[model samples]
Target: MEFGFARHMFVGALMCGAAAPALAQEANASGAATAASRADGGGIPDIVVTAQRRSQSLLSVPLAISALSDETLATKGISNSAALATAVPNLQVSSPYGSTQPNFSLRGISVANEFNANQASPVGVYIDDVYIAARTSHGMGLFDLDRVEVLRGPQGTLFGRNTTGGAINFITKGPKLKGTEGYLEAGYGNFDTFKVQGAVETTMVEDELGIRIAGNYEKGDGQFRNVAPGGRDPGGVDTWQGRASLRIRPGNGPLDIKIRAYAGQNRGTEAGIHGLEPFRTGLGFFEVNESRVGENQTDAWGVAANISLELSDAVTLTSITSYDGGKQNLQQSSDGAPIDVLNINWRSTFRQFSEEARLNYESDKLKLVGGVFYGWDRIVTDNSFYIGSVLAPGVDGGFFQHYRQTRRSYAAFLQGDYNLTDKLILTLGARYTADRGRYDDGYAYLFARSVTDPQTPIATTVPCAGAPGSCAYDPAAIFNLKGRNNALTGRVALSYTFDNGLLAYASYNRGYRSGAFNGGSYTSSSGINYVDPERVNAYELGLKGRALNNRMTFSAAGFYYDYTNQQVQDLRAGPVNILVNAPKAEVYGGEVEASLRIISALTLNASAGYLHARYKELALQGVNLAGNDLPFAPHWTAQAGIDWKIIDAGSDTVTFSPTINYFSRQYFSPFNSENAPGTGQINSELQQAGYAKVNASLIWVHDNLQLRGWINNAFNRKVYAYGLDLRGAGFPYNFLVPSTPRTYGVTARVSF
Candidate 1:
């Protein structure tokens, strides 16, 4: 099935490429201005990216990358993390804990359905060059940004930590030393949603120091309706975040420094889940019958400092230091039912510190970057689960699990690019990483109805130290475990630039992800056992260029990966979820993105992707999962959009932008079960069928003021963003999280 899809995509890409030049030529014959002459008018604007730790033109970089400017973000209505997938090809974001935590997957490489806050995602996320270590904090810091760059494939050399999938860099706007400037925006939308975002910047000292402050606040009544009697609706949105930045450059000298501090909190209702079983509820997809409504509360903050000094004409030294911490107290009804089948309260706190120093040297023929990094992080989790009402009808039963983990990482990396000739370059990079961690203070207590009290449940603690059948806990569980790993990873590539302004490249990379202890353990310590690290060897070929006098710009890439020891969360292991290693897997994909200026008043853009990811050798107990598709990996993804300048006048212009995105069928679990007897379905309920969404925006600019109206998911397509199988827990249903429905709003912004 996947092979045929790949062939069709390849043919379609070739046809599009063949037709673009003719259209551009026709536009040129109509006396349209060259793209370089009217770059800001309608042509595809040039983008500068820092994918290689240095500022370079996106078209010159020999890698698969997609960059979106702040203007594009607003025009496309991409306000949050999940919306990013709609714009970038082969990118997926799934959030089990609502908008608080999002797991990013690039090209079929992802963490699967692991809801543990302590585990780091294979896809590395960064903000202004500072790596975010915890997935809980990844959802924050999306507001008031300059640009977002998504680099596809393995980023093993410069970003050597856990970039087995890829990397996303969210570069925020900084303070400019040019007087005072600011912008303020406010909007109201459906579900009684109100939003306010703004940023202000000022110069503290002439040519020496500048300061910037930015913030975002949003509140809504929620979209999910609860149909159960006297049940309050869930899925509301209430969150606010703020950031402060300072930039210092004494006498406009080579000594540059930037310091930033940010904080945010979410106090909204928890995201609602839908049960797949017919007996659970007869409510609609957007209606839930949850009896116990919960709240999603989280507090996060971080501080970072970036310093750089020029030592010589060709040498520069840079240092980055950062500290981040967060706390989360979340209550959830996992069963999505009126009865107390599965209720959970999660309490976790995490802290991390990192320091990195690197030296960059640039000469006429060679460019080099070398760095050493040291990082430490700790997480403590105390979770309580209530399953008594479902397991034993009248008896109150539950368990409390407490665990703590401290991890340290050290690494040294070096990458250099040498110009073999005027148009040919050779790139080689390597890194050595050592990861060490200790998991301890892990224990669980099972409780039931007290003997003295019949109506109320009391603390009837039973530890795993008791005899067989005495407690519902695994006896062979190890409460304390230590793990260490040392490995080497690198990248090598050769790129050539044509005189016609085209860049072609081929490269190979080795990526690695550190082992981790499962933080979702509840019944037994064995659930928290150490899982080995995963590795991947990736190869890629790519092209980036322009056609028909630079009116059309495009990038294309094809890649393949040899994966081993992929970590996957196994929920079929009796009563407790375990982190197991998939012996082997294989992945291959291709993507093409292009933009063309049809005329001075219109620009058309499109992108398409095809991925094939499957496990080659995987078996658990007696069930074989070989040839099953990897989680969150869709076989096909596509997007088409247009930017039309319908009106243009002095100090006044109007633009209308519309986009459509599509995704093929994808599974959320690794099992990819073909039959679910409980639901009488031919396939697993944890899968989402192919779907498409439409988004559009209209903006009118008059002098320093701009007004805009936007809508997302205009067709109101019903789809699932995430899912979990509960059959192993003796439940006859699957928990599913739905994507946002149709939303519309209008906003006005004033700039100075």
Candidate 2:
């Protein structure tokens, strides 16, 4: 559970990757030259990525990155953003609130336990070069996607919005210029899960215009058996999504434009929660006793337009514009008991608009890219709490809060790479950003009335402590908080390429995250409403190479981060949650990824990540947890897999692949407590033990058709995704959200 072990393991992995080829075969110039020339002979296809805003080889990117292609995602059964955490190194994903709002962490940098609708996350999410500012919609389903790229460190230069932790880019397939193609897919699994998807694209006007359309629908029964008295289904999902695109090539010239529109709807029951004492009482893993099982409903839609003009072979201009909006309604029980002590209902809606323009120039000696970005968004949220059990008999009472906020941001950035020598390159990037945020209106009040009274509760919408009807709304009271700031961030890198396609690079980057208003009811208890920006300075060294006649690829990186003004969730006198700035923190880690083709029919893949994140100076309330690790940060994460083509027909093939992922024990809270003192009872019920799971899939492919049978979490291991301590809210125990159990399914697809 300590960082010392992780460090040692990381060094061992690096040594193994660096010396493997040398030890396996003697060094020879002729052999290295032959491998460098075999670009098409590989275990996996060459992955081209846009991590730096341009198409390039994945291995050539200077930053630490992990990529998943459409085929890879399907084979691995990764259908959403949250599942990506299990496949990538140094990454962890959780849904403390629900699956619609996922929280992500990379290299020990994360934002946990803060759910203010107006506060943005440090981890940036982008689709088709447009930023998604709300966490609620970041967990977009993966359908008809080309690939997904995860950049592990600071991305403050090109991606300027809140990118202190890093960025995730979801790239979807686009329309073909002169082709008529499509695909159909269907799947069935245990738990009554069913899915169907289809896509089509055609050239409406030969080489002048093209159109594409796609859609997906999925539904499944509850993974957990709800045993609550008189409770309905509590853990099921129903979702549908649709997309359309038009690609225009005017006069068959160099001017091209694409317009894309998409919409999605989700309606499902909330996740089930288990009490801490349930396990001790010999109950099932997911059994719960609750009188009220809440439901979740959401609607989201967006449109994006992209225009590209090739002024010359060496220069081009591009423009991107987008608008996105979403609304959500959710209600859930807080204590997970039949006699509910607290129930919460949350309603939220948000809208955003963004515009970006870029220019590019490239030549044999130098390449340049620059862009300007503007974004605006408005968010509104309402939270209502029903506390009937805590009030006097027949005296139903509760609290209500409502808030609205707006944010505007502008940024300009430029990045260029120049060849210093035939073997060395220098890269420089810089960006300047200005941000403004305002809390337009906020209101809160308490209401109490006798339940026996025939008349309903006459609750006022305005904030008032005096008698009823004597209340009024205020714009400048204590809630009209405004914040503005400017920041400059950049990146510097030096890379060298050898004649044998080997690359080594070192980089330094400064990252920034903007401040925002905390739109919540906490102001009534703690008088806190605003949070400050956070910053990070990072250094990295990396190496990438191909060997064994281009059949094997290897990569490794080591990084260090000096973080200041780190934002964290804190508890005040009323035990109310709020966002506060931590003085300082530090994180250092290393990771290695490798893929080897043992033979033309068999391949092996492996990756490992290590991190040691700690708060160098932190004081919360009266407790000082200076050396404690951040929540959700595990010391080590790793995965290994093998793909074997057991049978090969002239025009058909059958393959089997198995993968196993492992993670060290992780703490869900800064306290890092595991068990009650001098007892085996579960006291610090907010930690997950070290565990591993195995997954396997068998696939048959013939021409343009495929059939697959897969099983995930094969052994049905019991794991917890998140936890909460309910003792402070008059509950006698804690609660845990259980992870999905074993699932098996069959899928079929056809393409023409």
Candidate 3:
């Protein structure tokens, strides 16, 4: 994690970007069409995308999007959503607390605090057209997926709620109407890991009905062995999931229907933290010193239905309905030491239901899509914390909280593209959304200290019934709040496509994120229960094209955003953080992506992103942070890779792929202080250093069979993925979550 090493890697990536064309030239000098060339037919494969609500070639789409196919996922060892950060530019995903929750940021725009269930994310996440409402479930297994699409701009039209920072769509493999196919894959890796995945699809009634089934199971030992007395192991994966889908289409009819159901459960060790005690412990990376039993258990299930009807030769009507729910129970040590002074347990449940209908019309000169959506969500949570004698004398007690929240939303949108000429097009889109939220009967209490208690002691009544100030939480304390807001967002664009397959476009979009209540742990107090909505107006210009007769593909874009009433998370007191609205902010960035098929046997890919994000006007608690950089906003992010095919024949092929991802130094907190620990600093000196992760894989393919051996984090670099400053809580410690260590594994797969 040295600065010198990071600089070298960054320069190397730029060199790779410049050498792609030269490599293509050298490949042309050799006159033979190798077996690899014959396999690919001497051209880059066209990728189909649905970013614009329609099926089109990726090269013709006028947006900044990064998409990965199923094949690419397997070759790159991208097993979960967090790993996707390595493949996409200007995108970051992390688990600040544990593996159960995932936080995503696009272009330095993200939810500042993710600990509360009532907070809404600016980035939208969807699965099979159904918006995922719970942040905890965003880390679900990525099995049997057709594609993962990331749209990097404001998506206000023809999409669900809160897309101010863009959207991520997970498209799963659906049932086939005319064919039967399936695949089985199994793998063995480090930490005693064993995993299996299988998927099958068949046409039950020959072009009329079809069915598909998929399942996944993985289990392993903990990554970090516990060395503390009475400490439990952490970082183990024990989960299983299954999915079933059905497709019904009457013979040659214009109507089609799809039904899908899925369920998953996990019971394993929870996530732990490593405290940075440089002077005493000398950088503890993979170990946690805690005297508690860590447990992270969860259950999730959902169902969805999609109906499409062709009203005419040029028009179609579609209806989508979905229901999703998840439950979690987690317990972990919060002190990151063996003192047993602090521990947290959270039990929560979430459910959401949504319905959407859209009308689409396509013709030679015009394309139009309009939609209306309605959604309802509910959450119930019970959180408690334990305090021991080590932290406070005769103050050993637990704080218990219970709350319920419900939200209802309605939205309508319209978008159209009109071709003014054969190569010129004009696009216009708009959406209007209204949201209503309510926090029902809620209460909390703190129990009296018990000297002989081995665990948190629960009391039936509040210990401080009349004197509420003596206890952290009280049953007499009650909160019933409601909030409502409405917004109108839109987009406009102009585009032109040349006859030689080059497309360029310029666009402006306005998007908004809904207002929310601080209804969870921090709402028991007065005057800080609600925060205003956030809005962003973004401008983007982009170019996408193919050169060398479709052998090389490139995309580039520049963007700027104006933000208002931005929601910022801040800590007011011990264990009480509130979301506040900032006056204004500005962010600007650019990105470039390129892929060159140097030869039939060799291909090169590289991408880089630059960002300059700062707070134009922000004041909290009499402290001005107008000139500070946003949290987790890195100046540069780059990735480079090379794919080589050693042998390609009718029945056999061998290939190797190596990739490296680099990220510049980034501040984990907005305070951006670089002082020594215990210096009464608001922001700990701990920052995520610039680092690189090297990954490689080798594959052997024979007709319908394949074998892959891969290594991730090949150098076993001690990189920090997440960090938290806890100086305000009387503990001068910075907890760090390290990246996974080097892991090598072998996977075998077969297709029929």
Candidate 4:
């Protein structure tokens, strides 16, 4: 995989906003709407958004954003950012480490691989003004959410740092305006998964103030096995979470405040897979009744504060401060089994503190926003291991390594919109950030094999140490790694418009993700410092408009991303894996969307995107691989949906919606396109060929009551979703992650 990373270069200048409202439509996974309309008003309802440090209509800002209505979230079964892919168009979701984390990409870009607080997500995620520093945190279930806005492209202006591919804002609902209300949801699905959720809101001080609390409990039998000769029930973990908030209006003053706190816990078995050969893999892949390895357990907690105040006649100031914490301890497993007994136990923890302040100034012809942000974080990880296969010693998984890191970051930005004419608008934005990072990593390894089966010996032709064929295994030895890194980065943009609904935009966005010591540092042989940051310069253009009596909406855009000092993972013979700054790359693509109200109660929406995604260049340590299609990146994707309101049952309304999506086959590994077994050859993923899936939902909304349910993967089509290479033999050793199966659930909410 090529890591398209860029180092740091700071640049900045204020471009005041004195223009008209921006032109863009926000779509959540479920419903669709361009303008907010109210029966009470002649046209659209005033959508008050804090996206620019001020509550404004969606169109007033020059940005590409998608919003998921509170009702839509309930229909799609999306509790956090992980479910965002179902409706947001160009978003892709995956969990590489396990179900415990959410790894995402907006337009084929993502964060560098690392499990620590020092590294920020490529696409930043924020909830109620407080930022979620790690991707894992994004997996937490959301409750009492009012709306979710997905901002596309660069949003460095007036936002906390780290958004290279845009940002996602999770806005929760405020105190009930008419009084007390709440909801509850419960369901059972495949994998013996059981889930329960509930939320309670109360008007503690009548019309003066209120409080809300929500929580979730989920458990299930995992899908992997632990193979140890006469094995036991390997690893499978279940988790739970809770959240609370307090909203205050304080005697009609110009200031209002909201405070929230949360906590979570998980306990289960650690079950990861490993390829034994070609046919099947995992704990039971070898047809074993059981395996010797054991599982791990985990738990964690945190808090946040958000405040809004009107300082004077035209200037409004807002402040947000938060602290997040997490911890996990597990007895893990690794890829490839040299066998003799190897046991790894790891404990990881994170602490992050951040503060942001912003002010918005509004006027008749121009509007502007500016903000300052500072963040401090630290992470500590401890690893313990015991191996008896190589048999050089018997500490039985003794203290193997201890890792610690500290990171501090700060940023300042401003944006302004100018209405040059009655119809023309201009927008400008800029941001500057400074970063400092440091870490300490210590690791070592001992020899030990899985006592029972003891790793099988390797059989291969030896070219005789000095010959050219291959090196044969002599006396087995343990492997280990120890490494470290640090860095910084910054961005700017400008856009213009005209009267005929045509718009043009240009932006310069810089992104960075710090390097880290791959666990490889545990081995005794090689000494590799760390992997460097992947950076990108993005340039783009597009158009947005309404047509046919405001019944149809359309938009089209193109973009080019230039990458520098990319990171590439290298897998040599044996179990030696390392990361290095390889050759550079360039990506080109365009996206288009169209929606029409076919009839009064029916509507049609569709989107298409093409990415001429190529490496442009892929040189390793100096070897040029100029024209390779970037690994795992698909060239094209398209989605379409239809929603119909069948009945407006007087006091209730019922709507049924169906959606279908398609993604061309993507490569599983860079070297394997022909689907070769041992030689790692697979021209392209055939089993995962471009396929389509259908999903539908039934919703019933009535006075004081809302009932919703959905059915997914309706056809039960089996598809190869994701896999990894364990050794040189292409199909010899690998692991597969399956897509979730069908599920159906009902949620009920009442407001009085």
Q: Pick the candidate with the highest TM-score.
A: 1
- Model 4 deviation from the true structure expressed as Cα RMSD, one decimal place: 8.5
The sequence of per-residue lDDT tens digits that candidate 3 reaches over residues 1-752 is: 45555455445544544454444345443323333553377667777888887888787788899988988887777887778888888888766555667778888887753356566667788988789888777878889999999899888887877577889999999987878999999999998989999999999898789999999999987776667777676778898889999999999589999999999987767775675353226424666666574777888899999999999999999999999999878876666676655677878899999999999999999999999999999989887766565335766766566778899989999999999998899999999999999976666665545423543433322222332234453346566778899999999999887655567899999989888777444323442366888899999998776556457777778899997777776655444556788788889988878877889899988888877888899765446778777777787888888889988887999999999988888777666664333435556554677788999999999998999999999998877767766665456566566667788889999998
Candidate 1 has a TM-score of: 0.93
Tell how far residue 146 is off in model 3, in angstroms. 0.5
Q: What are the Cα lDDT values of the candidates? A: 0.82, 0.77, 0.77, 0.56
Instruction: Give one digit per residue, the lDDT tens place, for model 1 in 211-262.
Output: 9999999999767888778866788888999999999999999998999999
By lDDT, the best candidate is 1
What is the number of backbone collisions in each predicted candidate, taken in the order shown? 0, 0, 0, 66
**Pairs of colliding residues, candidate 1:** none
Clashing pairs in 3: none
Where's the lowest-lDDT run of ten residues in candidate 1?
A: 451-460
Candidate 2 residue 568 Cα shift, in angstroms, is 1.8
Q: Who is ahead in lDDT, 2 or 4?
A: 2
Q: What's the distance in Å from true for residue 390, model 2?
A: 2.5
Tens-digit lDDT string for candidate 2 (294-377): 877777899999999999999989999999999877777766666555677778898999999999899998999999999998
What digit string (tens of lDDT, one per residue) describes model 4 on residues 1-752? 01111000000000001111132222221123335432132222334566766665554444566667776665555655566776665666654334455656677665332233234666778877777765556766666678888876655556676555678898877675347777776766555667777788888776568888888887776544334544443334377888888888777577778888888876755544343443244424312222444454545567887887988777788888999988767654443243524345666687889999888787766777778889887667666544442333442222244556666777777777666765555666666666666655433333223443333333111112221113333333323233333323333445554443434555555565545444433332343345665666777765554444344555556788776555555543433345555457677776665555666567676666566555665543233556655544556566667767888778989888777766665554443343323445333432255565667778787986766667676676544545554334222345444454454555454554
Candidate rank order under TM-score: 1, 2, 3, 4
How far off is residue 559 in model 1, in Å?
A: 0.3
Tell me the deviation in Å of residue 748 in model 3. Answer: 0.8
